[model samples]
Target: MELKLYRAGWALALPAVRMLLARRGRGAGMRFLEERLGRDWQARAPGALWFHCASVGEVMTACPLVRRLHARGAAPLLVTTNTPTGARTATRVLPGAVGHAYLPVDTRRRVARFLDRFRPRALLVCETEIWPELYGACHRRGIPVVLFNARLTERTLRAPAWLARLYAQALAPVRGVLARSEGDAERFRALGAHRVQVVGNLKWAGCPADPAGPPPSAVPYWAAVSTHEDEELRLARIERMLPSDAPVLALVPRHPERGPAIAARLRAAGFGVAVRSRGEPPAERIWLVDTLGEALRFMAHAELVFMGGSLVPAGGHNLLEPARLGRAVVVGPHMEDFAQETEDLVEAGAVVQVDDEGEAGRTIARLLADAAARRALGQAAAAFVAARGETVLEAYLAELHAARLPLDRAPA
Candidate 1:
């Protein structure tokens, strides 16, 4: 079987994998190992719980559960993130209470070592992180795994039949699944999960704490948040079309490392650009919010926001941040992931949908020009977020509580 082969492959490659991981540092593979073996790691309280969040979004979604776990005396909430950014965000959010680590490569030995050392009470898997060796190791140790805020898009369900079966095999050890939506629950059932509950999307409640201090600057601004490479250039084009009297434009690149290159491109196209961390706030044109974690701060001040990833192939970044902050919202045509939420907002006249760069530019320009329209949209956006958020978060907490009860006393 594919699953057996995968386990065997990891077992066979353990030595080389260990060697490779040992040298990889905190950027990726061995980061998890380093943190696991770090000073405080061994000092963790007994019977602590482990929660795996795949990346930034998953980590954001898991915060509520992590908070609840810690409140219930689940000391040493072991949190692992696959991305460096996610690790940074976790540390920022969880502070002194949670342990941050990189997730090891899903090799059998590494997973076994990780589980044996930590011996978590229960494993809460956020979103769709279905690691075969990891789950298998957990099963062997009688640890229950729960998938919280679970979802399966149409694209996932449309994968090859063998791949679907492989997915089911990977998740077989999971005790319960808390799906983000009814559609997600149906997909899990089709893929052969035993128990799936249709909890609403967890993102509805995922707002980071408000940033301390005033807006970064006094300049009236509008933000283009989580903008991708393709979307960034398109945004520059949009900026050119705006009236000079319009508010300052803040462009936050999704990847901070890409900031310089994007700034260069935007400058070449004749826009005045100020990279947030470096330059003084320009009296004239765009504010390039090229720093990490500051986009949310900038979003809190913007008059209108264009959420990115939707502009291109990436499904979309979380839009709730901008909406919850009561900013008028605009997004592109490709938000397959947040399509339901986006549609709901658009129908309520809270969010503006645009087909491409031209439309995006015009929509933003119009929103800026009409103060009344901006105010009405902002109110609508905030209301939409408030109405749906608590319902989703409470349901997810209930599911997490249910999943944790059975695994709390397993002989580890």
Candidate 2:
């Protein structure tokens, strides 16, 4: 009954959702709209593995997996993302042969159109995507579905009973769950998911080669990467609290598209700002890194890197992105999203976790003042990531083999 209500709710809200998509899909052209509606002119050739990554973060993290799959020459691969930004990341990062599309809205009818057209053999839903209709439709077709890099946060575990019931139903058809941690596996089990296994975090083994180059400015700077809007005001406060000429702050907003607004906000707050997407040179106060796919470059060059999404209610982003780069990384206390990664890094002194923006400011100041200490933290981060080894990909491939997935043969 709960699942039925959930679908009905989606059905009723779909009109408004279409308006919302229209707004989001502005200037994206007609194909974006077509794909989101589960009907597109792009006739998908059926011989390909399919992966659904909901957003930019998942799309970026899925690169390593996609590359591994692409290398095997098993089949053509198709990746669907919910947002245009996610689609862009898939296009930019995934190999040229891979296909990209906007995942249709999760109504049974729309999802059926998508599934029927592609006829995917197996579907790997990245992270926490639990679209009931999508899962149910795939299951009805006998498509093997796996939840990759799966996690069930405490916050999500505490969802209302109705949601829990709906999720349990959604997960029923899921064949396997590749959890990122034991705690995650336990939570999935408690939530009624079957065949859960702890396969480690795939983001831990991110891009092997960094596109990092020299720091944009000769002036020493520290970066706050993937920051949210709410946290932007806090960063403005933190910057004001710092000394007259503290290392220039490289403020990289989580959504590069928001760079203009963020830069305006920081400027109105009385800071000199330079917009990178506009080709402006680095400013004395803040360098707004508003471009996509270049976060690692700034992170690699900064004196110390502060991760965004942590200081605010927004769940933290891929904290390990910078950690793997061997940079002095710090995050705010709200790291519920990446708790295991933060915990592991904190235990090894590879990353600093603070209670609030106040502590973050102090930590940034202290680290900026003491280069040797910052370098020590960076070295520890490097060592910890090195210790994690490169087995996550192999572990996932093994899971496929155990499931009797014919990676090297035509789909049966």
Candidate 3:
């Protein structure tokens, strides 16, 4: 009943959704547009293990699993993501995968077209993308679906009844769930997900530091990374509250496409800014680190780092990205998305947690005054990440074996 209503709603919204997708996908190329619209694009051979990632974050998070699958399995692999950035990352990170495409718009008709194109043996989803039409179609077709690295936030679980009904219906069809935490498992169970298990965060094992790169600029620089909308401004303000000269500020917005607009705002606010996409060097006032795939490089070079998305209730990005780089990391109080990591790191004195940007500035200021103190914090973080070991992948593979999924070398 709820599925019928949901489909009806999507039917009404389909035109607008297509327009939004077209606008967002500008310059992503004709193939990108066609694949997303449920037409064109190369078809996959039957029986591939299909993975759907929502965007850049999920694609990156799934890197460890995808790489493992690519290395061990003879079965063809296909990855579909919701955005162009994700497609580009899949091309970069999971180059061995046989095919990558945008996930079709999530109406029954479009999703059915996509399924017919791929004919996947099993569907593995990353994180919290719940599409009722897609799930219902896959279930009706008897395709096995597993959600790994899954998380359900408290706010989402407690959504109003109509929305919750749709989610419950979507989850009911999932064959298994590998949750990131026990709390997440419970939340999924409450949402009617079956066969849920706490397998720990895959990201903990996925994103280790890359070999350190040359400094982003000659002067020492610090980064506020994965920042969402006004967060770039908010974290950039940390400079004003600093006691002495802060390191050159790299304001890395989460969305690279927003770089030009963000730089304009920074300039209007009386800060000299340079856009990375424009080949602008670090400006005197603020160097807007406006490119994809380089946030970690800046973090690795900096004496201090701040993970964004926390100060403005955007939950927060992965803290472990910089932590494993042995950089002193700080974050604001609204890290609900990474609650466990935030708590563990804070308790261990590995990451400094503050209530707001004001506290963040003060926290960073004190750390700047004492080089030894910064090193101690960074070392603790790196140690904590290293101590986590490599269990998530093994356990997740075990889950696959137990589920009768053939992940070993494909049948001859």
lDDT of 1 by residue, 153-238 (tens): 77777877766777888777688998887778898888888888888787887645646347888789888898888778788778
Best candidate according to TM-score: 3
Which candidate number maximizes lDDT? 2
lDDT of 3 by residue, 114-148 (tens): 88877777888999988888888889988878899
TM-score order, best first, reads 3, 2, 1
TM agreement with the true structure for every prediction: 0.85, 0.85, 0.86
lDDT of 2: 0.83
Q: Which stretches of candidate 2 lie over 4 Å from their true place?
A: 41-43, 154-163, 208-210, 228-246, 255-283, 286-294, 312-315, 355-362, 386-389
Return the candidate ranking by lDDT, descending. Answer: 2, 3, 1
Per model, how many backbone clashes are there? 0, 0, 0
> Which one wins by lDDT: 1 or 3?
3
Model 3: which ten-residue window has the lowest total lDDT? Answer: 403-412
Q: Summarize candidate 2's per-residue lDDT along 141-235 as a digit string, tens digits.
A: 88888988887777778988998888888897788999988988999988889888999998876855546787677777789999998788788
Off by over 4 Å in 3: 158-163, 207-213, 228-238, 241-246, 255-285, 290-293, 355-359, 409-412
lDDT of 3: 0.82
